[model samples]
Target: MAINSLKRLALLGSVAIGLALPARAQDSGPLLDLLVKKGIVNDQEAEDIRAALVKDFAANTSAGKLNLSPALTEFALSGDMRLREQFETQRTIAVPGTASVANERERVRLRFRLNGDLKLQSGWGAGFSLQTAQNADSANQTLDNIGTNYGIYLARAYVSYQPSLNWFFTGGKFKNPFFTTDLVWDADINPQGFAETHTTFLNGKDTFEVRAGQLVMKDNAEAIAAGAAPTTGVDAWLFDQQLVYTKWFGAENLSDVLFAPGFMFYNASTITSQVSGTNKEQAYNGSTKYLKIVTLPGEVNFANIYGTGTQLKTYWDFTYNTAANDRAHQSVANGGYGLPATTNKGAMSWLVGLGYGYGQGKNKGDYSLKADYRQTGISALDPNITDSDFAFNRLNQKGYKFSGSYNLTDFASLTVTYFITSRLNDSINTKAPALAADPTLSDLNSTNTLQVDLNVKF
Candidate 1:
């Protein structure tokens, strides 16, 4: 055969080997050397074939560009950054008392986050995220006027064991296991805990899922010294369980008439050390209670609303306080934080939300408008987890919130939100002489907040 024809044959063989073999096993040097020694190709021709094979492999394998490992089955990196301007206003409107208002404050804040996940071949995986924030409930760092250095926190870290596609277990600081809204759990709060989830596919477009978790809210060495029982080394723990059902009407999957309804039971223990004789739930400050909250939450989704690529969604979350009734009964006898004589022991809280949108704030022209109304009683919930942007994190308030967002690109968007709320209980304000004297601090008045945000994600 001619040397030129041999060189072409060697090149074709080398390219075939590169395509046939696994990415990590595609090195062509040994085969090229063998071909050179057999006299089928010269040294220069062998080197040329090796170079072409390397180029082909590089173009075909993701590991060549991303530096990914061959042993990993899946890997991903994702996150978002946000810039915000917030305005908070407090005014006492049309009240039968001396008018007192709080000075409005405007602040600028920035948030940056990065997350990575790696799934190994043995059905196990790990993931982590880092974010800028001052507390667990928020990931935003205020742009300081004094040029202070920003701070970053470990937001999430977890390892997962997936025995099958339908079952998984996670341990460490991880996202909340239960499906929820900001009405109960803050969006930014990743609880330190262990969780297990299982899903069962039912007949024809119906699915059932169950999730349970034991989360650590806080740890107190003082409680340990004080001999707090039923605690894991003096830790405040939350036990949660959720049972959810997803039903799809017709045959279009998520785009059709889809509804997800779920029931959640949450109980917190050993969160407050200063427990009264019988009112054990009334330990965490005056507003919050470490108690049991039973919630029913559901969402109804409409796709292609009004002939546009928009989805009209409506959600409702109703929570009843089993522990609050117990606390209320104890308060009358134990003389606790001024519960009204005729106050209903069975306190309940609820929120209703309506929204229209497409995508998860991903693409350009992806926009959403959402409005929510929430009414909470004083003892209905642990107010510590309430959204800080609403009513200044106050319980015993009835409020409405309006939010809208427009995506500018595939990974960037802008959002605007407004919140207004009024106090639900006027008697509680009169119970406190100082609050009754100051209208700005009174719960009977209304407050408003407005915020604008620009966000980028990858």
Candidate 2:
């Protein structure tokens, strides 16, 4: 028998057993013996086939290798780990009804995440990620003397379909679809919903995209107890739509520039204080309800700036709360939880940021520096969804943030970040009375946070 034909037959047999070539060849010794006995092929030819299978396996097992099948066109795995030490401090205005006048906190936190991706033949794909954390806003687990075991959760699990090169749809818990800063949606928030994006290539150097998504923020089961429809209570939800445009300017010497501008409209369903429990709960959970928020986000980036293998980026984000009055109405209708009724008006918030060097470090000595300034009005943005690490996640606070990072190796890095909110809305009559006891925000004047992290990825 021809050696090539015998090799093909052996490969088929191995695939039937779901084993790769080299391992399959070794396990096929009995079949080869039978073939030799039947005079189908001599022992020498069988040995040669086995040797060729080994060579093929050796050639295939390289970096980025995948064990592919008819149904599984591609597969990949990746993950990261981080260790952090954080310190936070805040001072209050010392009103009579408050419980505490000052706050200080310190913690050591760690985070790890692992992800898997799969691509099918019919333009469909799925992804799953496991992350350490019990909270949606953070993947960090704090180390404590109690020897508390960390928790791992399903941070992301989504299925995607790409009907064409220009359109894509995804469902399940996935990354946020809107182009935004952490001002509204924290980087850690993976919204659970259906999301879609369509891209149009305007020209060789320009592109436009439309992104939309609807997220279910909360599902109240109060109806079950009240003997009503399942959707009786306000099913907290968010609707988002955005248009993004991008243009690439030809390189200027060693630097290439790109400018992107985007507009987003975010809407929330009924946010009633009746169901939102205490003052803290109302502030954090019900803040997004009954509001129309519009955002304009713009960015300019220069790659290889100064020819030092660096990139410079600047961003400006402007947000207007069209329903701030509505939120204020809800607040006043609820008796302002104890305060006066003078806080009823829509508000705005703006942020400007500058970044230097590679955004995410890649190699040893690689570094990044970033600074951002944020000014927020009382009713500006959704407080519940903002970055928790920023000023203890307070709204109506003005602050500056500074961050720097340096890579220790290709997959490991050290980073330091500091945030200072010098001004805050702490007037007793301006806030609900229930919040008067919470030292973290109520009666707050200013707060500061410092964090150091050692990050590793693969």
Candidate 3:
């Protein structure tokens, strides 16, 4: 049986080489040819290799070794949402609202998510996820031209594989490389379809894991001078790579600390061209340009926290950021182009937070105080057409939040979030006109929002 498996593997390897992957990936030639020529890797050796790969794939998923099974893997999920009440305060009245007093409103939202991993017996595993959430509307899905409590959400899916320990591959709708938390506005919503590094490192505890992959984004291509792009494909220029390391800092009885930190970079090509490695040359003929739908500039995070699996844990997280202009919209002022300059454009931003959690097993409760600040250098009039263009235009968006959650039971929990935002734009183009409308533009242009939510998880 083992000998027969070797023959099959060798034949498959030969066919694979005759197809798509880069030549070097196949070790420069087909398996049969190599074996025949080398006079090595005997049939016996081939079987050993096959068995090793099978073991490696399992180890990769459970322990990390060589091959990653292309099998279907699914995750069990259940989520529930209670009710919500909101209060908004805005001093500037569009017309005469009769009073400047803050107004309150009633609304309800459904938040639920589930994912599955399907690894076929044929060595082809696919992954899928479904998330239902209602946070304020984004610029993505909206109707009636008004940003209301209407259902506006994100749906993403992707497929991945680890053909070998040193190599991995993936394709589909997913998250971009930079930043943490898929829910840019809400952390509960996990994003998808991002290619990532599957490397391992030895740390004190369970070793450090790293993932680096391309980020697929949308819009802003023309605005950034990245001529012609696929509506739904990954932008290699926009890469997403992360590094995470977990360990038991102290003794088993003492508290433990888990630290995951790394850098982020997403380069949406402003111009089309053949990019081999780090070099980007100019391309005129219509071709695919990399694009990732994002606003927050690339960032660096040093998240440190100490806690245990039982309950009651504490964490202190520090985050540093570099400004990125909103490439979604552009004007003729910053040179008819939209991307910011290599220097004077996107400024710097950072955030620091401290928190504590209480719970047992999956049913957990927590609270925290977080402060965030980000600065954009590109003026509203800036262009994203040239390589020098900044991804985000504007300056100084700073805020603070006090949020908490109480798990009423295994199936229910209550959450409250409060935020204060302040903006400081460059006086020159601070009031620049917007090229695209915000999906959440509703009863008012701006106001402070207070939100409350209850959730059930299974």
How many residue pairs collide in each prediction? 0, 0, 48
Q: TM-score for every candidate vs. truth?
A: 0.78, 0.79, 0.51
Candidate with best lDDT: 2
In terms of lDDT, model 2 sits at: 0.70
Q: Scored by CA lDDT, what does every candidate get?
A: 0.70, 0.70, 0.39
Q: After superposition, which runs of candidate 3 have C-alpha atoms over 4 Å from their true positions?
A: 1-82, 90-106, 119-124, 133-154, 162-169, 175-194, 203-206, 219-237, 251-346, 364-395, 425-447
In the range 260-371, model 3's lDDT, one tens digit per residue, is: 4555444533333221211222222212222222232222222232444333333333333332233222221223223324323323333445444544314544433333
Candidate 2 clash figure, as a count: 0
Q: Report clash pairs, candidate 1.
A: none
Please estimate how well model 1 matches the true structure, expressed as its whole-model Cα lDDT: 0.70
Per-residue lDDT tens digits for candidate 2, residues 1-458, read: 45676566765565435444454444666766776798877788867756665555556545214445768878889999999999988865544556545689999999999999889878999999899986777898888767667778999999999989899999999988778888877899888888899999887867788888877666644446446555535567677788888877755432333333443333334444432133222533354555577888777878765774778888878888777676545532343333344543436888999988854588888899999999765566766567777766666678999999999999899999999995544443333445434422233567889999999999
